[model samples]
Target: MAVAAFPDPDLDPSRWVPLRYLNFFRLVIAGLFLVAGSELQLGHEAPKVLVAVAFAYIAAVLTLGFPDAARRIGLDRLIMLQVVIDIAVLATIMWASGGYRSGIPVLMMVILAGAGLVAQGRAVLFFASLATVVVLAENSWRFFSGRSSADFLQVGFVCIGFFGIAIVARLLALRAKANESLATLRGVALAKQQAVNERIIRDMQDGVLVLGADGRVRQANPSAALLLGVDSLEGRLLAELDESFSDFRVRCASADGALQRMRASGKLLRCRAVGAGEDGEGGGGEGATLVYLTDFEEILQRMQQMKLAALGRLTASMAHEIRNPLSAVMQAAELLTEEKRADVQVRLVRIINDNARRIERMVRDVLALGRREEALPEALILAPFVASLIEESTLGGAAGRDVFRVEIPARATLGIDRAHLHQILDNLVANARRYCSGKPGSVRVFAVDAGGRTALHVLDDGPGIDAAERLRVFEPFFTTHPKGTGLGLYIARELAEANGATLELADNAPGAHFVLTGRTQP
Candidate 1:
């Protein structure tokens, strides 16, 4: 049968531990032999030589045990050399103590077994054979010299026992090493999987929390911390953090893992609690609970956006039908204006034209929403771009182009679609012009660096937006002005996002401020 291969002890530091243990066993055996030689009548043939050989063996074992011995002599050669010394010294001791009859030859079994375990594979069989030959030679020499009786059968049995023990020890050692390697690999795989899971949970948008049976937090992700409005929730009691959490946990537990809702940081959160098991039984073996939190307001906004998208598509499909009749009404109003109608008739025709134009603008805005185009990004320097855009704005021409102020760094840049930027700026600048005092700096446009990004700010010197209307400012069909179409700001924000940008309302004390933050490099 083929022998199993094992790792080298020199390369695998942990395997060297067994070699140290083997050396310690040698020391113990040598010590016992020394004490026996001093006190006991071991044999009549050279008792003094027995004590001398024991002392020599002790010195050899101690010398071989130095830390650098393995590195200098090489591990395999070192172990082979130690086995040779053990056999030669033990055989000498046996010959002095009456050969095979003194029972000293039995110590060879321990030496062979230690060698087998420390140096596995074919080395084990080599140690076993070497010890058998040395002991048999010692027995033969003693009998031929007439110093002891012939005991070939006893010597043969000891040799057989040596081979049996060595083979068995070597096999068991190989099994143990194989199992250890498998365990190490499994541990590494489990650690990597745990790291990936932690990263996913940390970056997740929804909140995740782990709570012990005692209702103390065990782990919390960043999203959970933000949703709960706390710096950290780990190791803190749920009730201490907020009564809403305490009540939510109780309700989820009572309802047997049903979804629940609770108010946190003035926002409604959709919450669910589950145990560790696949079935989500609230009290698994660990008695721990996994809780998930989602923003109910965000869910509502998504539903509203779906409704608005559907409404926009429907209006777009009927836009042509509506505009055809509206065109006829506007043409008839124009003819009436040219005919020099009476005062009341002229007033009615003017109102008709104005209402018809408003409807046409509404249809055009709805169609634009339905035909949301993919953005084509390009690099744009902010200062020149803002200056040119302000000059082309409808309100800028009436208010005088110089009335708008631009403050951008010489190298400030943005990665956004040109047409998208033009539309967004037109809406914002028009709003600013309508509200701001007709002064050069009443409408200010500036850009600032923001963490490798660029933020373009547009502010007007007018009464700031009321807090109540701020929340609805970005909603479609919502407006504070009588003649304004509510879709302007909403469409502007949408266009910004289509180009990987964000349009946000900033808290400015004296005027309405809008900031568009986007990529700095293409």
Candidate 2:
């Protein structure tokens, strides 16, 4: 039985080249035989027969070795036919040139070994058997016709050698095939791993670049391309892209440290470079470096969120502890005010009551931070909602109806929790009313469609916020107003975010403008 046959050429493309190489080997051997035979006058006793056999052999090899002919006849059959032809033609040439004494049969060993390899050790012993039979028959015929003396022992040893070589060739071919299969499997696995790595690099938010010793980009992921403000980064010099990259590369190569630099595109990136090796050790001879870029703004935002989270936890715990003492202080102040005392005593009681009430409001706002109720959002028409909020704010006679102007589309809608929206608008409008001039249109409430969301803007005619104060206006317990608890805007923003909305202070020139951007529909 033969070992596993070579994989089909249609399935494994590597199979086709070896078969073509075998055919070419056969052609070369045939041509060499014709050339050597004619030059040496190999068949002096039967020159015409020798020449005719040689030409016919060459013609047969060419016809059978054609690529299309092999494909049409099928690979196994074609290989079998080629090996058989090799045995017959070579044996005939040996007979014409004084039989095995001419050393022509030695070439038969090469044919047998090659056949075993090409067919992946299949049917090799059969071809050896056929060659052995033909050689022995030729010896028998020569002895019987008195043309030459028979050496049966010599022929037997040669036949044995043929079988031995064929068997060894088969074993070698089997080992070769096994190794090739293992290598192919490893190659496939490596390719899959490479694809996964590429996908990870491509989808990463941080930019990554691989640079060679020449400071040129050998490979770059999509984020790297975007950060560099280029379409592609491969094969381009870092210095050519930007001077900052050159400096960054130099700084990183000298030592492992990050370079925080802003690019021409106005993006602040923190770049760090490391050797492309295990544990950031030196890589190959080319000295490759892996550069990473992170956005500075995002880093700052993350830090701010961490700080705020810690503050919330601290304030929530403190508010719980302060509530009981704060209530006691207010009751004591009220009891003291009931006594008929001096005018100075009355003024001191008033101050105590006012401060106690303010602390109570602050404690209430702080406690609200811990209770984040789930928002139930619904769509509300813009004009009527603002009109109703304005009416409620003015019912206390703090301002007249005409003091505030509502400039919203009648059909425009906003998506938010009903109570949450009312609270947000009330806080904004009240803040606007406190700051604006006491005149019509001094405090304006307007709405505009922003993409699929609606932005509700509350503008006042009061002095606009300072540039330095803009960033901290939404922070809890941070306010410029003396009487303000400062948690109103913070709580309002928290509620806005709970309903998938954003409240921000827009940079309007004349006055403080707060914009509440929310979904246009529920």
Candidate 3:
């Protein structure tokens, strides 16, 4: 079995360019030195100088030309070998040409510059110390061999000058690196803070909308879009998009922190504006304002539900307290009718009958609150059903002859309980007939198939509900007329909702319009 060779740990394969460039410059310099030495030697042969130049060329090729192949064959370790060989070649050239007086010691500065550019601080310092040792050793050797004192002084000054320049350059490079590291750290922290703020904004359940000073919607989260019944709210003005919300105005002062909540359409809307701080300005002035919107749709719904529950409880208590007196009045009227005085008894019976009927209507309205909704029956074709209801109600004198008119498409069908449906229609038609008494009015019932659902509309030409009264018309025991129970519309709405249908007051040309819409089954 053959053993696999391991990679060299000292060499970085990715960083070959700097090393290659350094070696190429080294080879050029060494070639110049070899030519100069040969010219200065005159008739003498400078074999050592020639040998040093050859070795420098070989070192350059080893460092630059074959980094990848050398790495594959475990010759990558020879990079350090190449550096050592270059240093040796410089030393040999110095010794061959007048030792310290050859000006070859100046090459140590090039070596130090290379080390600083390509290697770490400790590595560069080590190379600098090694070059210093070589210079001192060459000087001592020359001195022992009887060289002049002035030559040693010249070499010492040159070495000290090179060392001082190296120290200053290294200090500046280190300071620059420290500043860069701090800036990178600050950038990372700022990115994390922005991410956190985005997460908080997205996770909010309440509809949140951010607007600019020009009243254009800058940002809207998913909940906000859903609440506003829009696909996307960005780049739209609040007043332009929604007819209900308009003329939004608020003042924000950086000097004082205050928030105001505005109420509109029975819903509370909270808004806040934040002004720019002093540092936000280009020249240290205040910055732009950011507006935040918080919708209270859910809050308003809860309040309405609570009010309805309270009213339900009050009506239950009132019904119990009034039933006993109503029963006594009805019984007293029966007793008075049995008396023999015809004229007095006749007047008393009329008064008793009128009051008794009023009490009975009130009791019936209160009892509707306690009535449980029945299950839906099978689907019924709408045209025939609506026709039958019109004929029966008309014949029953609820709406007198020719008082009610109906128009229904023959193909329309609806899933509903026929009994409850009839009851709802009866109440509406009866209420219309009663209100239209002594007035030239007509009741109209119409039906159509709308998007796979059946829509039934009951319109009366008696009186239309005003905008102010429309909202309260559905409340129980809240009637516009003295004889009206006010429970008719409320019960109609409840029955419609129980059958998975919705009853709403629609805008009519002239009169009250009540529309019911629900899915139609085949």
Candidate 4:
């Protein structure tokens, strides 16, 4: 594995080029010190040898280019060599221009500052010691030779000032280094947090949208695109998807921050909006809105299940009261019909008997609802199970056997309770056969693949159900046929839910098509 790079200003190799440019400034300052002496005619002039050395150092810096070679030589050793060269060059210039007696020794301060910039820890103190020694040696020689009037006491304080510059420069450099490292760490942490948030948003079951204040979609997840039935959502207005979504824009404008439910993709959806407030695109203008959309049908279904549970408890209490009274009424009507009644009286008795039987059937269905429990689903072959269901639904029928066909893979299987599956198919197929008028091939049962799930469709050739009534077709006690108790479809839907499948009227055009979809076990 390769090692990762870290932000380290003190020991960083890239600082080499900058330090080299700083060295160039040192040469320029030295040249000024030399030229100043010559112009003042103080007999303190720079020799040809000192000028040649300064030019040679500059040439060496340019020839090396942008610190590439200096990096290869390693940081500690390279900075040490550069410090020695700076001391040597400055000491020579001082000697040529009049050291100790003149103010030429102050040029050594540049070398001290450069050492602090490039070196780490106490390395600057080391270079400062070297600078102090060179200047002190020059001063002592001048005093001994009677070439200067300044004493050792005054020169010593001037040497101490070099150490002051080194200490203060080192502190500033270290502070800058610490700040850079902190910024790098924060940047890495922010990036990781952003990545995690994106992953979670992509996988959420509910839809999420970031809408600009201009009403255009700035960002959207897959669920949002699917729910709105749009191929692409970016840059599209929310109200363009459907007329009902115009309410979404209105809600956002008011900033009510309340949950609302709307219809989309033929399903009910719960939506909520949150304001971002004038910084979404970082323009400091009005921010975008965050929209969350959840399927209200799921929440409604759960609430419906809870209501059904309460109803089951209530029905259990009144089951006997309802069944017994109806049974007694039927018996009395039968006795009256057998008393040699007239045609009108017999017809009245028949009506009472037929209605009493219908009530009895309804009672039985309600009793079944109370007994429903958690189902234990098992794998069953699709082809054989469907073949058997078609025969059983047609057997002993008053309308006689109607045409039906089965089309499914030989090895295809489904995970469901056999009885529940039978109930679902029986209700759908029986209803389809009735509408087909017992015509051969007019009633069809076929298998279809619905987005990786296995589905069975029961279709008829008769006039289909009206679109207005389709949504409420599975509701209990709702029926268009006078003889229908209306519980068959409701019971079928309950059975489908128990087995973790879905039964819904898929289409009403050409014919009424009901689809029973299940997860594939194989």
lDDT of 4 by residue, 362-464 (tens): 7777666643475667877888888777767778563444477566878777777877787777878878877875666777777767777778788888799
Query: In candidate 2, which residue pairs get closer than 3 Å at backbone N, Cα or C atoms, i.e. clash?
Result: none
Q: How many steric overlaps does candidate 1 have?
A: 0
Off by over 4 Å in 3: 1-341, 368-371, 396-401, 436-441
Quantify how close model 4 is to the true structure by its C-alpha RMSD in Å.
Answer: 21.3
Point out where model 1 deviates above 4 Å. Answer: 1-11, 38-44, 254-264, 278-285, 311-522
Cα lDDT tens digits for candidate 2, 1-522: 011234344633444556667667777766776777767647765777777887887788778765566568877788888889889988888888788787766889888877777664448889999999999999898999999745899988989988888888778777877898999999999999989988998899999888887888888888888876778889999888877776775675544356555555567777878778834445323578888877777788997899699787757745754565576667757767686768756776766776677787887876665544667889989898888888888994645777888889988998888888888888899999898888978988889889988999999999989999999988776678877777889989998988889999988649999999999886
**Candidate 2, overall lDDT?**
0.79
What are the Cα lDDT values of the candidates?
A: 0.79, 0.79, 0.64, 0.71
Model 1 agreement with the true structure over 403-444: per-residue lDDT tens digits: 688899989999998888888999999988888877778888
The residue pairs in collision within model 4 are 278-286, 278-287
Candidate 2 residue-wise lDDT at 506: 88
TM-scores for candidates 1 onward, in order: 0.55, 0.56, 0.41, 0.52
**Over 4 Å off, model 4:** 1-14, 17-43, 63-65, 100-106, 149-154, 242-249, 252-264, 277-285, 309-522
Of the candidates numbered 2 and 3, which has the greater TM-score value?
2
Q: What's the CA error at residue 489 for candidate 3, in Å?
A: 1.3
> How much lDDT does candidate 1 score?
0.79
lDDT of 1 at 230: 82
Pairs that collide in candidate 1 are none
